[model samples]
Target: MTAPLARDTARERSRRRAARRNLRSALLFLSPWIIGFSVFTAWPLLYSAYLSLTDYDVIRDPRFVGLDNYAQLAQDPKVLQSLGNTAFYTLVQIPLYIVVTLALALLLNRAGQRAGLFRTLFFLPKMTPPVAVGILFLLLFNGQNGLVNGALRTVGITGPSWTTDPAWIKPGLILMSLWTVGSSVLILLAALQNVPTELYESARLDGAGFWRQSWSVTLPLISPALFFIVVVNTIAGLQTFDEAYTAFFGAGNTTYSNDAALFYVIYLFQQAFEFLHMGYASAMAWVLFALILVVTGIQLLVSRRLVYYEGGQR
Candidate 1:
């Protein structure tokens, strides 16, 4: 009994030593991430939350106002307008982006030997910087001499002023947003390639036509990619800033920055930096964060019903 007890104790010590070594290695490897999160991410988030409850400007110390900023948000017309703009952008852009990307992916998937070249060509647009895209879009959508209007003139069609016209500003932004659909197309293309050939064969054998097979088999198989694109693009649409700002709110162009292009993030930026309303901006940021959380949660809930994972239970 004593001999067996000694052997078990030795084994236990060896296991404990191995666990300690593993833990030390893990901590060593994770130290950079831990430090980065604490310094940059976690600290900023906590500080912002605290700031949201105070009256803070860059030059002065924060004074506790205890939700005054949030209360004021209810009556702010700009806030409401910005939220509506963002919501409209999110609702319109996400579905259009998904549809366009999916269609491009389907086309590429059917391109046979030319698929790789087509994919590379399609993906090139995503590599273009957002600022550059915004500038390009501004030039393209210029009311008088822009390429879009120029083409319309050639066809004897009068194009609306896309940038200056309130009715067309959001539509112009949506059109600009479509330029970055390459990433979604690539994701869906990858998902499409992974879809089993056997499934397509089975689908065909059942007398299912191309559209019917695509509706049932292709869509279900690629639903995960679709869900990912929808969630990411919706969040991006809600936080739109760079494009609109670059196009309409450039330095010394305050007069051109109309209410129609006032996205939530752009408004928050104007509050924080331009107007020196740090606390109010912080509150707006938190509100935006909450909105994103709620939207993502709803999407997750809906996805459980809609998205499919092959060979796995729903």
Candidate 2:
């Protein structure tokens, strides 16, 4: 009995030793991610917050300017236009995206066709690099010999110079934006398919029609996902740079002519990199962060009236 007890104690000690070794190994394995996060994400975020409060160009020491940058943003006409442009873009894009995405999701959810082929076809636009797509769209909407104009000519109507004309540039870019709406459709389609079939079946027993079942059953179930897509796409639209900048060619004194195609970020980039105003750009980034937070909070608050959760009390 004594010998057996001694052996068991020895085994327990060995297990403890092995556990400590495994923990050490695990920590070693996780160190890379820990280091990367600290270096790339945490450090830069903290530094940027600090930079926002100072007026430091890259070549000089930063001077603490307090709220001067924020004050400037408030009074700047270009900033106001950019803000308005972004707001308009967000307002137009979010709903259009939601409608188009939901329509596609519903259509494809029951499409019964080979979903893989159709899904690939729709998602191809999303896969295209934004820069490439923007460049292609630039030509497609051109007034002369552009595909859109050619099509319009065929119909005995004229198309305006899309990129060159201020009146049509934003609209042309907005149309370009539609090409990537496919990604949202795919997201909504997933949400639609995730909805319980039993709910629709039960609703049918109550003499509900297709639209009725969808209104009460489908929409509610998918509301959570739709809500997420709305917020994300709104943020994306607010950060509209790649398409607008790539499609735009500031041929004259227009930094963001034709109604300020330079959305906040694009304008910020021009100020920071083009004009070498790092401190000001940093301030813009902070403002953008605040704006996004406020907008997102508003959405979440407003969503309470619209978004319905399953199996949980609101």
Candidate 3:
């Protein structure tokens, strides 16, 4: 009995030692990512939280100010205006973006052997830098001698001043958003191809026509990809800054309607860099983060019903 007990204890000790060795090996492999995340992502996140509670400019140490910045945010008219503009952009752009991308993906999917070439051609626009796109937009929509107006003139219709008119600015931006529909198109196209041909055959056997088959089979199978595109586009639309800033605020131009183009991120940039309101900007950043979190949460809840997963778990 004593001999058997001693052997059991020895085996347990060996297992414990092996487990410790495995843990150390895992830690050694994970060290680079852990260290990088701590320095770059975690530290910035924590420091921003602290900065949001204090007044900090680059020149001086952060002065503790509690909730004063958040209080000011509520009363700031520009904050309200920017939020409204961002909300409008998200609402209008997302549906149009999803429809256009889906339609293009369907068209490309039918191209068979020629699909690759068409995909490359469509994706070329997305490779252009945002600043260059903004400049291109300004040139194309210049109202007087622009290519768009030139074409409109031949058609006996006058194109509105897209850059200068507040009424046309958001619509122009929405149109510009379509220029990068290639990414979503590719995603949907992949999803469309992944859908089993058996499902379509079954639909055809049931006497379903083209529209009926698409509505019943194609949409349900590709619903997950569509949901993904919607959420991503919504987030991007809300954070719209680069193109609007380059077009309207860059090079000290004062002709365009800033109110129409003043997206939430652009205002946040102005507060942080242009005005040196670090604390206020930090607060704005946190508020935007919270808003995005809530919106994403709501989307997740909604997607439980809308998004289809083949494995049966939402």
Candidate 4:
């Protein structure tokens, strides 16, 4: 071979060897995350899918049962009831959550540096444990002698029995859920800070007041953040468990209506740990996963029109 041709061939071989070495190094660096995901996330997901098709009680070997568990779920009235309760909680709570958080964000944005202490104080509530929050809910919303009713009585207004009455139970839960909107408030506050000040100035020049500028300028700019919060909260609201379970289903609690507060995850928990229906709970989990996918898809479709991006791309 000619000298120039031999040199070109050698350079090509060296580049190929370097490429292989770089690929190996990259894989080595990523090995930990890859192994963790395989063990913790991917394997569990696949195993759950397999378990969903069987009759396993965490005691004996799983026996193949085909679609029997799903068929039973279809016939279960509690499924519908729990789903309805969860839907109601999500639908009612999300709007109120958005409004309250946005309002707080607006107030904080206006407060400027003076709001530093208030912002920290607002976030402190979110640091409280879920079980403690549930207990606090019972105390604050108690029917006969709670602080809420006491304040209502001072105004000559009768307060409903929040803990006992079925009608008030869900409302009380919703109110309790609102008590931890600190993270959402912080998210919105950050979004508000990112809104271009020039847009507000232009709105003002066009004779727009605070409300008009907010509606036209602020909301559209921060819509992506709002969409994120809505999606996240919707997923969380559907999986409602810890607080409601602590409030109504924990030991020494037989007063609240199960129909009012039996969220989907709580029912799934009952089936798995309480009843040892491991296979059934696995099916329930997959159903929830499917529902979340559908709901999130719908939200994404709706967000195409609602959520505005600065670069005009969703």
Candidate 5:
């Protein structure tokens, strides 16, 4: 071969070698996540989709039934009731939690240096395990002698049976959730700090009241964080199984009080593990995914109008 031709061939070989090395490095970095996804998440999701199309109690071999589970879901009054309860809780808790947490952030933001300590105090609840939080709230809201009712009785206000009464159980859960406003507060606090000090100063110079300043300056700037917290908190509240599970143990048992806290996921768990209806649970899971996706899509579309982008659309 000529010397020039030999050099070109060597260069081509070098380029191919470099490309192969890059490909290997990329795969090496991705291997852990790829394995995890395949084993833990992907297989289960795909299998559940398959299961949703079948009739599989854990004991039996899965039977191929087309859409009966879904059709049954339509006629299932318990499913509808659980969905309604979850929706109601989401509607109430999402707004209340957002408003309260944002207000706390605003209060802390005004504090400046002391804000860190106050932030820590508020965020201590976030450090807690949800299971512990549930148990703690359970004790706090116990009917016969609870902290809330005890304090109320001292001042001549009688506290109702929070855990026992079906009418009052969900509200009690909402109240318990108020203690864990820490995550939202942190998100809000970050947004509050990012708001240009100039904006607030200018509003003050313009003789704008606190409300006016918040309306014109703070709210617009913090809208992104507000939207994020709203979305996350709504989803969290909707899938509120942990708290309800710990609070309303033995719900289907004979001794159980009014069936007040039969949350959707808890019911799903009961149907799947407790009742051994895997197919039914899989169908329930798909319906939930659809509901959440629909709600989220609507919110995303609506947020274009409601959530003000700081410098206006990017």
Candidate 6:
């Protein structure tokens, strides 16, 4: 009995040693990613949360102010205006993007092998730098001599002052967003191509026309991609800043950035850097994070009823 017990103990020890060795090797391989996450992602998130509760400028140590920053956000008219601007942009741009991209995808999908050139042409705009795109848009939408206005003039019509007018600013931004729909077009095109051809054949046999088949068959089958594009564009629209900023706040421009162009992220950037309201900016960041989470959750819930999966499970 003692001999057997000694043998069993030896085997257990060997197993424990091998487990520790494997763990060490695994951790060694994972160390770079683990360290990067801790240093860049996790630490910043934790520090930002802490900073949100305190008043801090680069010049001084953080002083605790509890929830005062958050409370002040409630009374900030600029915050409300920015939020409304972001909401409007998100609501308008997302649907229009979906419609336009989906239409493009459907058109390309029907083009079969001949669509390669068109796809490349469409994707080129997305590869353009945002600042460059903003500059181009500024030139095109110039009130007088811009190409858009020139074309309108050729047609004996007038174009609005897209950059300077508050009413047209959001629409200009929406048009800019539309230009980057190449990614969505590619995604939806892939989904459309993956759709079973037998379904369309059956619809044809049932005497369904183009619109009817598209409604009952194509839309239902591609709903997942549609849902994905909607969520992504909504998030992007809420965080819109670069194009509007580059256009309205570019160098040598004396015109102040009006409320129409003051998106949420841009406002937060102003609070943090321009005004040196670090704590308030951190609070705003947290609020934006929470808003994104809530909006995404709501989308997920709504998608359960609307989106269709091939496997029939949401």
Q: Please, what is the TM-score per model?
A: 0.97, 0.87, 0.95, 0.96, 0.93, 0.94
For model 1, the superposed segments whose C-alpha errors exceed 4 Å read 255-257
Local distance difference test, per candidate? 0.91, 0.83, 0.91, 0.93, 0.87, 0.90
Per-prediction tally of clashes:
0, 0, 0, 0, 0, 0
lDDT of 1 by residue, 200-295 (tens): 899899999999999999999999999998888888888999888888886646645368899999999999999999999999999999999999
Rank by lDDT, highest first.
4, 3, 1, 6, 5, 2
User: Which 10-residue window in model 6 sums to the lowest lDDT?
Assistant: 249-258
Query: In model 6, what is the error at residue 67, expressed in angstroms?
Result: 0.2
Q: Is candidate 2 or candidate 5 better by TM-score?
A: 5
Task: Quote the positional error of residue 76 for candidate 3 in Å.
Answer: 0.3
Q: How would you encode candidate 3's per-residue C-alpha lDDT over 145-226 as one tens digit per residue?
A: 9888899999999999888889888888888879899988999999999999998999999999999999999998999999
* Candidate whose lDDT is highest: 4
Ranking by TM-score: 1, 4, 3, 6, 5, 2
| List of clashing residue pairs for candidate 2 | none
Candidate 2 vs 5: which has more lDDT: 5
Model 4 RMSD in Å is: 1.5
Could you tell me how far off, in angstroms, the CA of residue 4 lies in candidate 2 after the best superposition? 18
- Candidate 4 residue runs with Cα over 4 Å from true position: none
Per-residue error for 241 in candidate 4, Å, reads: 0.6
lDDT measured at residue 127 in model 5 versus the true structure, 0 to 100: 83
